[model samples]
Target: MSQNNDNSVLFGNGDELPSNASDNPHINQLIDGVGRRQVLAAGAALGTLAFLGSVMPGAAVAAEPAAKGLEKLHFRPRSKLPFTAIATNRLDSISVPTGYRATPFIPWGTPITGNYPAYLSDGSNSAQDQAEQLGMHHDGMHFFPIDAQRGGKKSDHGLLVLNHEYIDAPLLHPNGPTLVAGKRSSAEEVRKEINAHGVSVVEVRRGLNGEWAVLPSARNRRITGATPMQISGPARGHALLKTRYSPKGTATRGTLNNCSHGFTPWGTYLTCEENWAGYFASRDTDLPRELSRYGLRSSSRYGWDHLKGDEFERFDATRTTTTASADYRNEPNHFGWIVEIDPFAPESVPVKRTALGRFAHEGLVFAPVKSGRPVVCYSGDDSQNEYIYKYVSRDKYRPGRSNGRLLDEGTLYVARFDASGKGEWLALDIYDKKFQQACKAAGVSFADQGEVLINTRLAADVVGATKMDRPEWGAVNPDNGEVYFTLTNNSARTSVDAANPRPANAFGHIIRWRELCKDYAGRQFAWSLFMLAGPEADSIGPNGKPLTADNRLASPDGLWFDEEGRLWIQTDMSGSQLSSGPFGNNQMLVAEPRTGELKRFLVGPVGAEVTGITATPDFRTLFVNIQHPGEGSTATNLLSTWPDGPGQRPRSATVIITREDGRRLL
Candidate 1:
């Protein structure tokens, strides 16, 4: 997600605190360190600073000479994009290339499970009705094939798992939230909103006409904000997680603010919790580091605590009672962790894997698995001036034998990029000498591993981890094991570094790295800038030239790599900037990683962010999400009435794109 009015204030440590020298390394220093060799190898490597003029140690080097403009770089085969690059537009509907067909499907409030309740056009559906229907504001998603033994590529019939990031209260209701004397009055309204957050799993089948439809199956399920979930890993029984609902601290109720998502090798879905701190309110003057560093406000975002009952009162995380389990002070602690769900098994309870470390997780992407190697994955903290993290399992991955437990016993490391185009992954372990010394020097202490994982941000701060500009979604290249991540714009960034080069970076950039010695769990890595996203005049392309009309973009948010190794980039430009920004509306673009060439694939409707992308195993069908269309408008003054045309409310939806002829989507 991009920084906006609703979430920007909740992001901690933007410009409020000065950047320490250790946390902000100079970009010039890194550039100067490699300037001499880079100039000499300009012809060998693609003559662009975007590649840093260096290839990975074991990567295949291109022998052919480089070309100019949109021409192929000879680093990879010249496979042309199937469709023509679409032009930028501010249309109130989805726009695609000439030969592609984009169909809106599975929109918000679509019923697929349980009793299959029908959707009411007037937004008068009951809370129970919403519990059985699709949730609002779709984000990250994945498709699981029904036939598991078909090499996991049975795309004709599959189960779709998606995350409901947050709710638009004004659109969720007929006349907006009801409040009496500045307090939420209708408990049903609040319940409906709660049911609108979390994950949704439903079976879908492709018909003879090439359209997808939701099917009625027992595996279809909805995990909402009020559902029961288990807290697993080292922090499961910690004192900080003890709440009134779960006195043993082994469980928590639901997941909120689920933004981006991931999938495990053993076929499970991972939904990340982002911007959840603002959902809770604490009235206490003296706040702990967990709450203070996360920027919890005095009032909740949706005023859920204004009502009665334990479910509603838990939103107010103030220490009203003495005992830990007497009040809901620890309610806020239960969130901000990755929640894993089995979309194939509807009856299985979701588990919050805490060993990955607690913070505002954007998403996680696993490295290519080897039989004898440990499971390694990367995640980013989606907040201003935060740090990126990596998790390495203690046990080796045994293919079918490995499960979520592989994530339970592992080390969580924060990244520190240096000025020499090199980076280090500092472990947040209580036993590491570097961590111990840094914590003592910074006057910080932790009781055990649980505390260390719970206070991950503080631990990274003590170890002097590099401050990043709002790291969001991450993807790993299939051709090479290099990891790439999107550093969304940070307007409040007062410090500049090699990784985060621009101060007050409004147009974000993409960064990639290859682990040293080809070991993902290794501490060291080589880093480089992929591309700087912005207007044509302000942005730099992959070939070290100004970006053209086909490739210029801003605030790159969601990122993914397909089976064929093409990188898919999605944007989440804020509503306030859409009018004045050169980029028309939020869009999705395809990039040739080796060549640094990009082309606009699709453009979304007004006030919507193009995010949460996936593709069928055969690459013939592609699924993309359009979130919050016509956002920032009130009920009285509707800004967008898309998908349903002139008289209906704008709905966040998933779009299916296919080729005009029955062929692969590439």
Candidate 2:
């Protein structure tokens, strides 16, 4: 069964409400700070596919005179996709094109630096052993090119950094989480699960035999839930962030639910915290609106809190202490930010740059930087009817090893897409009178700028940002710099609108926007749907004929654009598609940005998602992650064991897909 994103069910009373802007607040601020009306005006929604006629054009960006051909930047003609499309299938193993070969590499439990025991078929690895092994549920990733001269040339020898989204306890341990008479039975077991919830930086090399292998290097390290991270940017040093361990609010321990990733132009890796709120439990009856909005008040996603000891107890975010710095009540505040790590410098500590603004960050992809231009990164809040965001740096970018200065001192903007094919980037700044008035009207309590950054969702709501389906991974077209994001299926979508026309959006769609005048930091953007994911029988081109086999995909999740302008899209399916269906297994396909021609490049094994893709700058070698085969399986009944035969535990892994003839992909 493909996973359904339904947030209409109430979180309490067994029927949960997805934290949406359900209430209206009267604010005496300008629309987009234009000093017009204080009453929030609802942006019109795209009511039908007719809005797509001007899909790629920035029809609403105020007409500014431009250089010759600058007007055509947003009107680039679509090109033909160059790969042969593979038929969808329900095969238990991976499938690829005729000329391509897939080799599984660096699977979960592959020891990096420890004298750890080999993984046993019976799932009996000790918690201490798992600390040194690769974590589970690999998601978004990036390949940092190892330039010997450090001049940024593409190299096959580089660090392969990946986000271990979460752990599947049932598949990892002998039995599911050990419960003793309704409470967590073993503290050691809980420790092991915590150890498996962060990011991994592995050294990958292309051997003489034309294969990629996990090589041991000084940088080969695992950052588990127990690792300490520094808190930097606007939200740092705030009183609300104070906890027993980091009383100053300048530090925290570990990164959780790391989903997608970004590679900084200054040579650092960004592992995003997506869906991280569920890990901690909040017990405060009079919880702050931000905490309640994030849904941490619900029962812990995992019962890590039930275990004895502060090490585990800190995960319970309830304000049990009369004063700050006595417990982990603020633990949830430290997470859900874009965590920055220097993969090249193994000794350096990871930093959570709070200027990015916290929410459920999907992937953070930066627009290509030019000299003296403020660096910009685009991201999406991954929840039903949430919002998309972008962080524009205060300082222009400098090319060199990461000094850790760019992400700090930045303004975060929430997108408000207009139904008439235009969008405005609403700045989430207190200096903006509208933002201040909305905060006052919404009753959001924040002592300072740091508090506002910590509680970004509240700020977004106050700004009246556009609601969207589950926005997943994002990609920026290197050719035209158009920002693209995947709106993964939202089963709760009960009404049709311009952006999401399908009432029940089971088949996800991709949307793109051209920033006005091709400026990466432009506030005005022209937006439109790029393509809708669905079955071949229903798929069609603009001409209304059946789309090619390449376009017959559902639920776009992982996305990337090769250096040569080829867009590589990966699929994620849940519920029914896991076993048998039109889109049998999750897959990765290559497509043309303009022509919208799509062709299936590869399909994952049964019961797994195709995610975490990157490639050599030359595009000769493409790396992809096949995550959670036998994903929802149980200890007693295994559905489909993969990356190993049946009777062996299924393991998530990174696979290297290369052309067999030792040439760049044709």
Highest-lDDT candidate: 1
Candidate number achieving the greatest TM-score relative to the actual structure: 1
Candidate 2 lDDT tens digits, 316-409? 8877778779988888888889988988777889999999998988889988786677888999888777788988898887666335678988
> What TM-score does model 2 achieve against the real structure?
0.90
Backbone clash total for model 1 is 0
> Considering summed lDDT, which 10 consecutive residues are worst modelled in model 2?
35-44
TM-score of each: 0.93, 0.90
TM-score of 1: 0.93
Q: What is the C-alpha RMSD of each candidate to the true structure, in Å?
A: 4.4, 5.8
Among all windows of ten consecutive residues in candidate 1, which has the lowest summed lDDT? 10-19
Which ranges of candidate 1 are over 4 A from the true structure? 6-78
